[model samples]
Target: MTNHNYASRVQNHNSSIIADLLVQSSDPQNISFAGGYPDASLFPSADLADAFQHAVADNTPAVFQYTDAKGPQELRELVAARHAKHMGYPATADDIIMTQGGQQAIDLLASLFLDAGDGLAIEGPTYLGAISIFENYAPKYYEIPIETDGINLAILEQQLQANRGADRIKLLYLVPDFQNPTGITISVAKRQRLAELAETYDFYIIEDAPYRELRYRGEHLPTLQSFDTHHRVIYVSSFSKILAPSLRIGYICASPTILTAVAGLKSAADIQSPNMTLDALTYYLNHYDIDAHIANMIPYYAKKRQTMIDALHKYMPSEVTFTEPEGGFFLWITAPASLDLNAFMYDVLIPKARIVYIPSQAQYIHGDVANSARLNFSAVAIEKIEPGIRLLAETFTNYLTNHPAE
Candidate 1:
């Protein structure tokens, strides 16, 4: 072994449970409900191909040149316009800083704010990707419980108040719209309360909105940033879900002061985002009706979402409870605390049922997760849903009956 004192962050770079599940599920023999990827068929490949040709054919030098550290200004302006149309927020391009993707936005924000042992707040069962990024920063996480309507505000207020004076919590990270793993959206009332709490407690709110554009049924709700009179909300959105993920384009809207720090961090990290990809995306946005494209894609995902919901209802045991997410690509399922999802998966699901799902233990920062899991319906085709879910339900039912421990 070499004698080198690696930074403590390297210690936590171990293989994650989610990563393991993804690897195992990659086997074609297993019917995987693990990945959160969008349906490949929905990508506008032909249109994007045409746009890329026109973008490169017209201006080679400009397209290949380095972009602004904060990303292409015109693309930021176009994102601002889209925000205006969908979110009713008139944030200027000055408030936006582009990043590699939403994941980079999170990492940049963490780098800008977090120091070792800094206090941060997050939902208990939150986005695994966010947890993966934030963990490396070594923040003291204040995990708040959540409900279907959204985060439990009473508990959140208690935590905020508890950490108020010298504790000085740095950021309250959240995925307010169609949150990952749980598929829960914060209500308007709770959203307002969050804004007020952030102002009162002197903490920033990282409002991640990757899946807001993928909503299928619910009425459009105002974002936390919209209610932030104190400018405490950092609004993040990504083109990964809405457009070509390979473009690796996403943006964050926050106060100029916060964005300045983020831009500096971005420059240090990557100097600038890809100019050619930004040009292609800009050309596509200018020439194409992306809203119309997403509109066309809705029914397909909506049908898939419903099929998963229906399959769960028809096949699952009575003790098995799950969320009926109106939109987005996930369905969160929970069983009794005694049921160990990982053990169940190894012993029953894979060997007998021949199905795989993302166990929720790794989804939490705290290590008490016993009976929760996440399933994705978007990647699997329409025909496979019934058989996979039916088999999974049967396996679970048989296991509960046969085994006495859980």
Candidate 2:
């Protein structure tokens, strides 16, 4: 018998709650509302195929060779320019470090800044993937309750005040624009207040904003990075949602000091993101009008969002509460307190309903949100949403009726 011991970090870490369930339940016929994946139908396959061919044919030897550790210059410039124009940020190529994807960007940021036992603040119900990333470093996780507008400022200030010490906290991780799981956009006032807090506390802010450009309704608010005069914000985003996830190209904008350090860390980690993908994306961006491409996606997602919302209202019990997201792919659902969502999922929703959802327990840093679940309407087709929600509602009703608690 061979025996081996795993590292403490690896042993202590829980497997990705949402991803584990997704893999287990994934079926071609299954109506999945679990993953944060974008709609595959929206991928520009023909255009990307053409761009890939052109990139290899035109660049030849260069396309096959390893490029700069900072990524191809053209792709970086394109990302900088696009963000500057669309996001109202003063981003330049020098301030941007191209990453493999948004996940890598998060990992690199965590690796560069955090040490074990340090404290990092996050919204109560936040992006689970980010929480997973930070867990590897074993940071002391603190949660600030989330409101409809954004992170509850009062709770945030209280947490910060309580945690103030000479050791100094590491970072405040936020997804201000169309946050994952919650799908709540932080208002402009909150963005300003968050910037002020970062400035006052002298801590860095990691704004993971993969879904900022996927707005289906309402005016776009300025990013927290926009108000960051002290260069305290690290704004990370990806072309994954807008273009294609397979390309694995994303970038981070921060102070030259921080970006330089992150670039070095990235170089040691992955050398550089594939130049072929970057070149292809750059070709696509240069040749095509990206704004028009994104504009087309808005209506597609808008209809899907409406479909899910309408179905939920029609089929769900009136006691169930959910948020109407202005942008992004998720609807945060809070079921009646009488229901144990985790038990309901395993006993009823997954088995009887034959549907998959990210139970809200996966979203919390401390694993305490027991009665909530997150529904993603982006990847699933609009036609299937009605029936899927019906299944979900039926499961909820069944659970409530069967497991009545006084």
Candidate 3:
């Protein structure tokens, strides 16, 4: 018999493939390209150690005590200053609210705006993690297809027009810079248009840009939030990609009203992120140069990204196509529509090659795209990239050849 005490909100939610695959990624035998893990070797261990020591020494009992739900004012100021420098706009500490990570920021926004049956629009193939979070809200999902530049604006506007007043979409979420899974960046024109559309349609935009600072090539584009004139954009980012995931440092920059409300939600949800961690981060920012550290990481990650792309070009079947992302931890692969990559991975690739990747089935809200996969490069050892890709290609080729499309 079903448990009656459970909330109905969780009734439709299923276990995410991402969680299971993350466990698979940890196995010593598997060449896992599943988790969006940063290169462990690059972590600023010594600096962080010193920073932690300084935090303890300087703040003492305060670092150990409860702090503001929006995180330390010092850290927020640092985050605001950094945002101003990188995003080409001035931001104050009041505009920033800290969270456990980008994930929490996303969750907070979803909670603040969405109710059951409320209209929510997201990229067709968005970050899988966000998909899982949105599941709890049970919002009416409108998935817009993505293009080389970004989401199809025409279809989005049509959807917006069709759904007006009570039916208008309440929230639109997107990863505008080197988007998760696909690693596609939205064009500046699209970014401007998105801001304009949000204002015109009277909806909010969540620019989930955790990977914004990781660009390895091309000219850096302005953030979607920068173009936002009506305070429609809630900009979210994290130190996970650039610094360390364990820091659990992420922030939201938005208008005063949104920031205040979200801060309340954040406070009620977890009280606040760990004060010690926030203080340490403050010390690190004060003593060290995060931008320079990020700069140092660029070439390393760039090489890793290029290595994976090169291997794909050299070994992947002619029919298989993959993205060449300028930056970001993962790249996307698209196979023939007839091929179900999830089945292929379990039935053949895993047993035969000991390889694992994030299949596309779980990445979308609809879970209908089955021929694609997301392969991560940042976590895997540099030496393993080519061989793993080659093996992955060989396995896929063998399977496709033996089981030709029916």
Candidate 4:
């Protein structure tokens, strides 16, 4: 029998596999390399507490009331200045709109551009969170392949050229800096060409770069927005990786015309991001040195990344290969195409070894790939890194050995 009536969109919207694994991770015995979480030890607790206290004490009744839908002007100005300095682009307060997080920024853009059956392009093995959000609109997904440096521009251009009518993609989503599941960064030449393609094809690019500032090893490349001669790039980023996730602060940088529509959608969605949090973040940025805080965090996360990579090198089998990311919370692993790592996890790895990592099935829109996984390094403790990876490596080797290629 059917339950109460529900919207058709509800059928397509389902919870992320990461969410289910997060619940499993609550157990003390289970070791998880699954969720993409930042280390809590690095958060600036004291400074944030002071900032919140100052915001409430100074703003009083004013802070308690409803603020602008675009968020407090002071915070927007600060974000614009910081973005301009770091991202090698010119921005002003008018060009910025704060959101619940970068996740909301992406959703808002999807709302602005997508309709049912509209074309949407994303990196294959993309961030799972983005997959969940984009699914709500039921857009026709073009799962573009990723290269060692970034998304395959050649293939993407072909798709753009071929689909020039009603099926042409309206929006393109990318995590150019140390992409979430793959840990690959797009090259400078591709960034320029991507911007040019967007102009020629008449589509907008959503540059969702939450991990851009976490680089531990390479020189910083310019943001996609910097290369945008036309206002076709909507840049989204967050403080969740650099600061605390609970803060729920992120911003969208785009042309004022675009932001006006996004702000309306945001206002309808949640009214606005919490006012007190915005004020507190503003106060924190004013008084504290976020750059220095980021500097301190680099070595801490860098150590964890190195530990995970070393463990992989020491233990992984010849058939299995993994990425060596310069900077990011996660790295990817690929096995023989026929291995079916998802089934191996449920039937063998989780029950026998008490180990968990995100399988490649959940990473793609259609969930067709079956022999890869995304392993997060920053969340697990330094002591558990080697053991978790070692156990995983052993399990994989044994499983592959016992069930040779069919």
Over the stretch 318-361, how does candidate 2's per-residue lDDT look in tens digits?
76889999889898889877676877777767767678888887
TM per prediction: 0.96, 0.96, 0.98, 0.98
Note the residue pairs that clash in candidate 3: none
RMSD (Å) per prediction: 1.7, 1.9, 1.3, 1.4
Residue 169 lDDT in candidate 1? 83
Predictions in order: lDDT? 0.85, 0.85, 0.91, 0.91
Q: Write the per-residue lDDT of candidate 4 for residues 165-246, one digit (tens) a residue.
A: 8879999999999999989999999999999999999999999999999998989999999999899999999999998999
**Model 4's TM-score against the true structure:** 0.98
Worst 10 residues of 2 by lDDT: 1-10
The global Cα lDDT (0 to 1) of model 2 is: 0.85
Over 4 Å off in model 4, which ranges? 1-4
Error of 1 at 354 (Å): 1.9
**lDDT-based ranking:** 4, 3, 1, 2
Model 1 backbone overlap count: 0
lDDT of 3 by residue, 1-406 (tens): 1457877766556454655787788989999998898999889989999999999999988989988898888889999999999986578999999999999999999999999899999998999889889998989999999999989999999999999866579899999988898999999999999999998988999999988889899989999888988899999999998889999989999987899999899988999999888999999999999999999999999999999999999999987999898888889999999998899888888899999998998888878999999999998999999999999999989878987877
For every model shown, the clashing-pair count is: 0, 0, 0, 0
